[model samples]
Target chain A: QCSLDSVVNKRIQEALKEYKPSIPTKTLSCVSITSSGRLSSCPAGMVVTGCACGYACGSWDVRGTTTCHCQCSVIDWTTARCCHLA
Target chain B: QCSLDSVVNKRIQEALKEYKPSIPTKTLSCVSITSSGRLSSCPAGMVVTGCACGYACGSWDVRGTTTCHCQCSVIDWTTARCCHLA
Candidate 1:
């Protein structure tokens, strides 16, 4: 049963791979979910900016550093996503 | 003086604009610092993922939704950058 499940999962993953391209093109940053039900790691030369948080992150002052920072709500930064500076 | 600051700010912004291309094109999501030293907003189709935080945000299960989420350390999520799922 486990083997069958693994095969099924692999097939599903393969299908997903075919369905999607390695990201559109010239994409600076992108997001992806994983089997563990979480966001996947970033691609090359990219980093994950945890824009969201459990508490309210008033504002981020990452100026003079790189491209920019993410936008977080005044409420808990629960919806924190990622950004890429391409 | 404030007026001069505004003018200088505008000139600096224009210079920065020329120095940078509107995100180098095809950006799914990105970050930018503001005059006040805060992150700018996301682009049209994409949203900001606050993957970082002052507290620890374990793996975010955004698998069902769109592509994925950001990455945060077990630490205080300080270095939480951004991701663009391109």
Candidate 2:
């Protein structure tokens, strides 16, 4: 039984050595999505990190965790800074 | 030899079962850092995903991969939307 356990431990260690290299190294990736209106949204599987607005409007908010809505009344465009794990 | 191989394979499977739950499930975490000037930066180990500025200024760019630089002639504040995997 002792010899069996030792052999199993050695095999497990070797298997782990093989498996460690297959683990993924994930990174952050982002993109900008702009629309010719007051609101813009990120694509599926992405989240909005921030927003930009036209007409020099600094006021904005995120809606539903995905869309950017510029608060200025006369805004012509909106941009969503979208990001995801890549 | 065949019996030893079978025992080793069973042990490897059990070891993998124990290890799978220990793997980290990474997610995206973000924060907004606001400063009382034209520039703001993310903390170390974080990256800038986007930026915001005061005085209704929408023109801006990232300086380095961590800092947000507002480009308006008169800016009172800057916000860096920083993110990282957690």
* Tens-place lDDT digits, model 2, residues A1-86: 67998978887777676674456879887777888899999999999877888777778899999999999989888888888777
Q: What is the iRMS for every candidate structure?
A: 21.9, 3.1
Native-referenced Cα lDDT, model 1: 0.38
Residues A12-59, model 1: lDDT tens digits: 445444443244354444443121111134444555544232333334
Could you tell me which 10 consecutive residues in candidate 2 chain B have the lowest summed lDDT? Answer: B16-25
CAPRI-style grade of the A/B interface in model 2: acceptable
lDDT of 2 by residue, B1-86 (tens): 98887887788777877775346778878999999999999999888888988887986667666888887789999999898998
Residue A69's lDDT within candidate 1 is 33
Per-residue error at A7 for model 2, in Å?
Answer: 4.6
TM-score per model over all chains: 0.23, 0.69
Estimate every model's Cα lDDT from 0 to 1.
Answer: 0.38, 0.84
